[model samples]
Target: MTSPLYGQMMEVPLLASSLLSHASRHFGDIEIVSRRIEGDIHRYTYRDCEKRAKQLAQALIALGVEQGERIGTLAWNGYRHLECYYGVPGMGAVCHTINPRLFPDQIAFIIDHANDSYVFFDMTFWQLVENIAPLCPNVKGWIALGDEGCMAQFRADMSVPVQSYETLIGAQDGDFEWPELDERQAPILCYTSGTTGNPKGALYSHRSTVLHAYAAALPDAMSASSSDAILPVVPMFHVNAWGIPHAAPLAGAKLVLPGKDLDGKSLYDLMEAEGVTFSAGVPTVWLGLLSYMKSEGVRFSTLKRTVIGGSACPPAMLRMFEDEYGVDVIHAWGMTEMSPLGPLARLNHRQKQRPLEDQRRSLEKQGHTLFGVDMKVVGEDGRDLPWDGKSFGNLHVRGHCVIDRYFRREELPLVDGWFPTGDVATIDADGFMQITDRSKDVIKSGGEWISSIDLENIAVSHPQVAEAVCIACAHPKWTERPLIVAVLKPGATVTREELLAHFQGKVAKWWIPDDVVFATELPHTATGKLQKVRLREAYRDYVLPGAVESDA
Candidate 1:
């Protein structure tokens, strides 16, 4: 063993507050715009946001709030919510962003589990706050975010004293300074959507967040810069909106947060009005936007690229965005356990010059790993698989930003040193990775694995099918085979046979779903990913027609 002398250098902790401070000092005049809950456009500058964040920190301190305490927020993507992202953490407290779409019981469970001292929520969730308040008796108080006049009724409903966000921060003079805490202190707490059991928490540190911001703002990531206007269709409450809120401010990009209105027209209007060049969100959000554009015969004047994650981006949607709208669709993959970003699609110069279809195919993959992350796929025997782009296995990753252990859980969630992502994936020789299917969701037909996402994407490519979910069903010969539950477009009709025939040449004949069931709609999670768990349960007993199919 060799003992080495450490290099003498200036040392400074990487703090979340410093990102805001940088913006305040260098890009103080850049606009941070939002469509407020009050149904009006609100505009502010980095200077104004920094001051308000300091005021919020001061107000929390005056309430006897101690460092390391948890503060909960059930708000949408807005300016005040943005303040909480910087403020609570800047004061050495953890900002716990709760997804409001969670059930009232889950909401209560999270608040109680985190031992939240106070909760700040948007007025849009007034009824949710009222219902969960009685259940979370440990919480110190409730505060509603909105105009004071719109909040009087909500204040009367809480058991604890409630105050409007304006009034609470208004009492402070923005005099507090950001505390210098350990770089390892958690600045954010986010829980996974409880699909299987009680949700688990992924606590993010000050250091990981700062590094994630730096990675996300890179040209290959979101391509955020001073010249670009970014509207994060992804909510701030979810994985810190895939790190855009922090990255945008870090790069001096103009931020346009789409509050509660994520419907197609609202997003189009906001994007056009703000001259938004880059936007990001899950595939479902972009689906709504594309549908609206095609229907209204409208086109984006300023938007250039969209980052789609949460689930695989359907090839059909990507084609529509590129062919019709001249917009680039970058597919991304990550999880709550990761600082929520892992691989993102960024083509090198040579890949960019390929034919558009060839380029689109590469972009459809989850993408290449960037700095701060590393990945490998392992088979059931726990052996590393070849990166041949054909064989797939369980995906595992480890890096600076990935979670080592979840909040409050003693069990180590890692296999060896890497975190198992619960996804079955294949990495090509070129270093691009593609998620074939979730480990639980992958369908095994005749003992051969099939990607449900591939099947579903082919199903939705049919003009008549609006949406689809591929699930493994009980079969007669093969233990479990793929079946697609499809939703048809409004006023559009297609036979079950027609939908099945659409996949003829696109995929292997055996990978084709045995049957298709048309329906009115599909189920999705709070953050808009499809709810395969509930759908699987709903079709658990479903039977295949005819005398036992043997196509596989």
Candidate 2:
């Protein structure tokens, strides 16, 4: 006979609501700062955030938003949006954060796809929601995220039920108790900003989200802590702002949410005013900040560290941050499917001991994976590639937070329990992964693979280039050739020969672009990623110079 087990531990669920409760109890005095849409700074404490969140929860329940129903939010990062993050999930309802920057069709599709019962939007998006409301029949009500008078005119104009966000929560009491919910219950939903197809939803469970927050707070990850003041420049609608919304509270850190005004001057003002220690955003956002700082001869007073992701961080930008600004730039990479927290480019002890140049090179690559995540690269034949840093293959990842299947999709996008990330990458012996290119965007020239990302990074490093992209232009002999499209800084000029000469000794001669094109501004996605697809389409029919074959 088997012996019985000893004492049983508590069976508490890892719901997101618990994070808020812990923050309120342990770090109630911590500040939650925001630059409101009305162009003013709004400040509150964690205790206030928790009380308001509970009141919002009561309001949600009173509005007949049942368990498992979807509550969509079309707003920027701010105190009210943070309340929605907790209140919607705390009440057992799924919080669907709609990206307002997405195309109108995509926004409408996502609203209908999620069957959102109520949409809480800010005054900035009033006209957008007004125009798209008729298309989203499933959306039961519209709540403007403002004071009672802010929405009065809109409410009077609209025939549907339009209410004020502040009034709704103010009418409810904060005495409501959170119900016991399963850890695996879906709490948040985010859609991918995929380049090719329509956006797909990645529904995150309460357990996955909470675990991601913990992993993101680790020293090697985002290194978030109570002593740190975080400024998340990344929009809240983008992958839960890379999980900062939860990770900040989980670590009891002070949060500074930048709403709407993402300009360099505005961000600089907030960082200096709030004494922000850490910030996170895409490369474009940082580029603007760095430019503004340089042109104005401004210096960072309190900003010390930044997390650059959404696209590869250029070596020039990384060096500028580290060498000139004395700030640590953590190069991170992840996807909406993986709950958006994966490898962070922080050096271990051994890596730190390496030569400065070697360490910088490693930092140039995407850093090692977090504790809970597993990564691998596979060839076309389903064989695992060696981690020698030379062999590149399809990148695949799996973990507690990775998605097994997309929401409402019948087919599972997995292979042997791993989700293919649709990226071509190489992993070194140290387990550092470097994304070479997207599988679709890779230029195949004379049966040899040229990484468009590598070329673009190299080209953008040029002193005169503000932005650059490499696309495959059709060729007669090689079937395809790389063409560099560059956007020069204001009043900056460079000849194609000079730009081509810059690639000398940096990369193979064949890898260099045969010709260069200049543009005033390059296109970018809603999340700030370069839109190469449009460039490819625009140059699809252009023939290579001195080509032997002509169009038949």
Candidate 3:
């Protein structure tokens, strides 16, 4: 005979709509700000956002959007887009955010693959939508996120029946009740920018998204709170703007959305104007902001912390933010498949007690896991590697937010219940995870592996170097040797020998790049990660000097 369990609570489903409801009820008066692409500022409150979201939901329902159907958004970070984040999922329809930065062909492919019933886009992407609309036959209608005049202009230019987002929502009242939805039902779909082939969709469940938001708002995670004015320089299309869209509302934080104006001056001006206390973006973005601020001798007044991801944040960047600007740079790591947030680099109390230099070194790592995610490194033979801070292996993660399978694909990407992250990393005894290299980008020289990330990081730390990437070049003796492709700061000059000399004491002699190639710019992905695949292709036939072909 089994005993009955006591203290059981109500079995309410963890729907995404609840987040909006909670924000409206508790943080109704908090401001949600947006710097629009039209060179203007749009301001509203949580109450307004929630009401508009409900109106949008009613609009979608009137448009005949069925439950669990996919609705696509091709827009920037703004209040309207934020409304859809709740509106689409809140009504049990999946929100598929298409990255307009992707190639037109890729965009068409994604729309067709998702079979989106309707596509909502901004005025800035009018030409893009017009170009790709014919390619995506599944898209039944189009909604331009603008006023009636803007919609009329779009309609005049296109053959499709385009509706104005404002008109549709304004026609509806906000009294519609949200339908009950299973927590495990898919509510959001984001595609990975695949290095090869087409992008694959990562359909996220309501439960996973809500859990990720909770974890992201924790003290060790993004540390989102009501007192902070949050600025997400990261685009909303990129991993839900690193999950800040959800986490900000959940924490009742004031959100400052920089819509398509990520330039240094634009970002700096907006941060100052909004009194931004915390922000999140990629290293390339911060590099520009730092350069602009340094050149102007300007400093942050209210900005305190920033979360850097999309790629590894260099140690020099971490230091510059901390030492010069008095800002904390939190290095983070995640992928599209993991609701895009996992480990965040925040030092514990004991770790903070160490020497500043030592603490900075630890902070340079990707970070330790958040509460919901579990990580481990495994060797080639599938055995778990030791967490001694030196053993590098393929990183594997399992968590409530981790994806078990891709959207519309039945194949499972897991190995023994763990999702392989394709990242070569080391987990130290203290739980700090450092990414040595991408598994495909690791440079092998003379039967030993060299970290391209390390080489790139060290090169960028030089005062004159603006950006850097390390790629493997063919060598006769070593088979493959590291080559540095560097972009210099404007008007700055440095010799290849001088650049190589800068790495002399920081890394092993063999790990240093054998040669340097100067360039005005380097290619990067839409999400701001270094496009190493393109770099590898560009330097594929390059031969290292003083090296002979191996006969064996």
Q: lDDT (CA) for every model shown?
A: 0.90, 0.92, 0.91
TM-score of each: 0.97, 0.98, 0.98
Summed backbone clashes in each candidate are: 0, 0, 1
Q: Which segments of candidate 2 are over 4 A away from where they belong?
A: 1-7, 153-160, 549-552
The 10 consecutive residues of candidate 1 with the worst lDDT sum are 543-552
Q: Write the per-residue lDDT of candidate 1 for residues 381-500, one digit (tens) a residue.
A: 999999998989999999999999988899998999999999999998778999999999999988899999999889888987778999999887877888899988888868998888
* lDDT tens per residue, model 3, 22-108: 888999999999987566899999999999999999999998998889999999999999998999998989999999989999999
* Cα displacement (Å) at residue 39, model 1: 1.1
State the weakest 10-residue window (summed lDDT) of model 3.
543-552
What candidate 1 gets wrong by more than 4 Å, as runs, is: 1-4, 156-160, 547-552
Question: Who is ahead in lDDT, 1 or 3?
Answer: 3
Model 1: what TM-score?
A: 0.97
Give the deviation of candidate 2 from the true structure as CA RMSD. 1.7
Candidate 2 TM-score, C-alpha based? 0.98
Off by over 4 Å in 3: 1-3, 152-155, 549-552
- State candidate 3's TM-score: 0.98
**What is the Å distance of residue 199 in model 3 from its true position?**
0.5
